[model samples]
Target: MARQTQALARICDVISRHAQEGRAPTALPRVRLERVSALTPPAGETLGPSVSLVVQGTVRTVLCEKTSYYGAGEFVVASVGLPVTCAVTGANKVQPYLAISISLQPAIVSEMLLAAPAPRQTTVSSVAQALATGIADPDLLDVVERLTRLLDRPADAAGLQPLYERELLWRLITGKHGQTVRQIGLPDSHLSQLSHAISWIRTHYDQPFSVEELAARASMSVTSFHRHFRAITQMTPLQYQKHLRLHEARTRLLAHADDVAGVGYAVGYGSPSQFSREYRRMFGAPPRNDAAHLRETSAT
Candidate 1:
């Protein structure tokens, strides 16, 4: 616990020096630091396979119906890409929120799986299931502080970052968050197979298909697929696809469109009325109003 406190202090100091407001990209790929000076409204975004460590303040992320909160000394891991609504809930002008994130790579995790001990579980339940946040232990916290210190010495990081990256991943598997990290690494695990199906759906979202087709793609029966898919994602396959479509449509609306009907069609919504209704449901406004608000925010 002493070491954890010390590490958090060091991490907070480094982040204060290196991270400006909002997300700051680090010298290493897939690593980022975030600083928030004020609480913000809830916003939806997609998070890739990664781990987020909150060194200060707090953030609330809602995935489907479940709301997970992460604060100082806590970390959240996402095994697969997920659409989530998040807000910076506990920051003020006086004390800002600070966080660091490391993107998880499947290839690296796969390699670690061969050497690391398997997660504790029954043979019937060997697959590592979906997990989110875990309180950081002293050892894991210590290694993370060392990893962040690399940002302090940029030249050495070029050669040393790979080593630290591997160590970080290994520790994650053996750490309190091991179960979730393990699921993401094992290529043959149920979560990985579901990830494949989700990937297929995301890439082909504009197209149509039934649950049976997606289930077959994942080599699972429809019932089994639905159960596990919903278990991990907190949404059914159709709901997931709808989110993808709506998110994509919203992105286009915010950035590239003057025609709401065109944006709707392009994102696979066949009917304009249906698109507007769903758009209102998701964004709390009609397409034009939301788009205008987003553009105005971006400009200012």
Candidate 2:
């Protein structure tokens, strides 16, 4: 535990130097650092395949009815694209929220899986199935530290960063969430199959889709598709579409607060009343009120 603590402190130092107020992109590709000095509002967004390591404060992420809380020394792995609401629940000026994220590449994961040894049987149930969190073991922490340090060496980062990233993925593939990371590389895996339908939903979220249509897209029967979709995403296909719609609507409203009804219609809500109702149900406030609140918060 002492070693882990020291490693976490080192990581915090590195991130604090490089990360600005919001998400700060690093010299390395697909790696970013985040520093937040205050608690953030619950905001909805879609996360692609990636790993998020928290080095300072706690984060609350909600996927449908399931909620996960992970703090310093813990990491969250997202196996596929998921629509989620996330907030930095623990943060302050003294010890702000600090995190490092690396986007996972299926090609690299697939290569590592091919050369990796056969798996051993285990009885570890995933935390949230698709979106799972695990304690970052010593080796994982070491890899993260090494990756963060590379930010200082722009020349070496281009060459050595890939190797370190592979090692980092290896750690995850062998750690508690191995199965979650492993599924991301498997072409025929359930997660990959669901990704196709998920991709479709993301692109055509504003359009109406039937369960059978999504099922056929994923090359599964209606029953199997619905079951796996819910299991992986914690939401039915329809519900997922609704989430994507609401999130997109919120994004639009933030930019054009006065275009509440137009934004709702653009996001596929035909009636302003229905849009306001559903928007209020998902977010705590109605469309216009929520937009005004978000604008006020952003200004300050």
Candidate 3:
């Protein structure tokens, strides 16, 4: 217990320094260690395929209507593509919220699984669609500490980081989150199938497709595909598409200040009114108003 606490403290120190300087950490894969001094409310949308660890504060993340909370000594794993709203819950100047995010490589995790022997009772089967899981084990924390320490040894990172990364994956697979990790590597599992479907949708979100076609692409019957899609994402295929479309539209408007109709068309909305309605429903405001408000706030 003492060692875990000490390691967490050291992590917090590292993140605090990075946040204070507002500089990205010089590490492989570009790790972002952050320390937020004020509590923040969740808003907007962002893509997260990263693992987030909280060393000194609490955070809540919402994805597709599913909410998850994590705090000091705990971590959250996002296994698949997701749009989420995240915020710090408990932080201040004296005890800032510390976080470290490491992006996941599905290829690496899959490689490790293939090269290693399977653990007992760990079948390569799909369990849940959501990849997010809470982890709070001492062994896992120790591995994370070692991974973080690699930042100090710039010379050794090239050769040793891969080994540490594999160790981290192995720990996750053998830890409480093993079930979800297992599903990601199994090519024929339902989660993997849905993941493939999701990748397709993301690549072609501006185009429309029939449910039958998507189900066929996923290699599942229409009924089964719909059921599993909702079970994992908490939204039907159409609903998921709508979310993706609106989110991307918002990005376009914010990044370029594009006209409402143009942005709508760019993201596949045929009618301006239809796009406005969906945008209002998903973001609680019309596209133009939301974009203007965001710009105004950012400028301030």
Candidate 4:
């Protein structure tokens, strides 16, 4: 328990330093350490595939309709691209909220799984939602400590970072949520194939495509593709596309304050009224009003 506490403290120290400076203190790619504090609610943001650990205070993340809460000595894993809203639930000037995020590299995961023997499991599936779990084991905490320590020794990072990262992945793969990590790597697995199709849709969401074409890309029958896609992601392919479109439109509106019609067209919406209706349904406000409110909140 003492060792675990020390590990968490060390991680928090590094993240707090980075967050104050608004940039990482290390040269690592795709992984960032941060500490945050806020008195008001934050706008929903899209979190790509990543793992987050909280060293102090608490945070709540909502993915689609599912909500998860993590506190000190706990972690959350998001295995897919999903629209999520997250906020610091417990914070103040002194204690604040300390957290770190490491983006999951699918290729690294795939390589680790390939080099490892298959676990005794029936099948693999997409982990569409976020997962939160407590950290009870000391070994896992040690791996996290070593990873963070690399930031202090940039010279040793190239050789030792990969080794430590692999160990971290191994610990996660053998942990209670092992199946979720495994599903992301297995080729020809239903979840793996669907992830491919989903990735394509996300990248080309601006263009319209038919169900038949998407099914062909997944190499599954149209009926089979539709069923499996929804089963894995909790949303149909079309519904998933709608989520991506609306989320992207929201980003553009917030970033550039783009015109409603222009933002709608930019995200592949041909009808402005349809875009407004869908945006209202997803975000609880029309585009212009929502953007204005967001701007006001940010200013304060």
Best by lDDT: 2
Which candidate ranks first by TM-score, i.e. highest?
2
lDDT for each candidate structure: 0.82, 0.88, 0.74, 0.74
Q: Which stretches of candidate 4 lie over 4 Å from their true place?
A: 1-3, 21-26, 39-44, 114-117, 122-136, 255-258
When 2 and 4 are scored with TM-score, the better candidate is: 2
- lDDT tens digits, residue span 248-299, model 2: 9998998989988899989998899999999898888999999888888778
Which TM-score value belongs to model 2? 0.95
Worst 10 residues of 1 by lDDT: 122-131
Q: What is the lDDT of residue 68 in candidate 2?
A: 86
Better structure of 1 and 3 per lDDT: 1
- Compose the digit string of candidate 1's lDDT tens values, residues 145-214: 8778888888888788778888888888877667788887777788988987989888888788889989
Lowest-lDDT window of 10 residues in candidate 4? 123-132
Compute the lDDT for candidate 2: 0.88
Better of 1 and 4 by lDDT: 1
lDDT of 4 by residue, 125-203 (tens): 4243334355636888788878877777879888888888788788877777766666666676666777768889889
Query: lDDT (0-100) at residue 257 of candidate 4?
Result: 71
Candidate 3 lDDT over 215-281, as tens digits, reads 9889999999998888767778887888788878877888766599999999999999999998887
Q: Candidate 2: give its CA RMSD in angstroms.
A: 1.8
Instruction: Show pairs that collide, candidate 4.
Output: none
Looking at candidate 2, the ten consecutive residues that score lowest on lDDT are 120-129
lDDT, candidate 3, equals 0.74
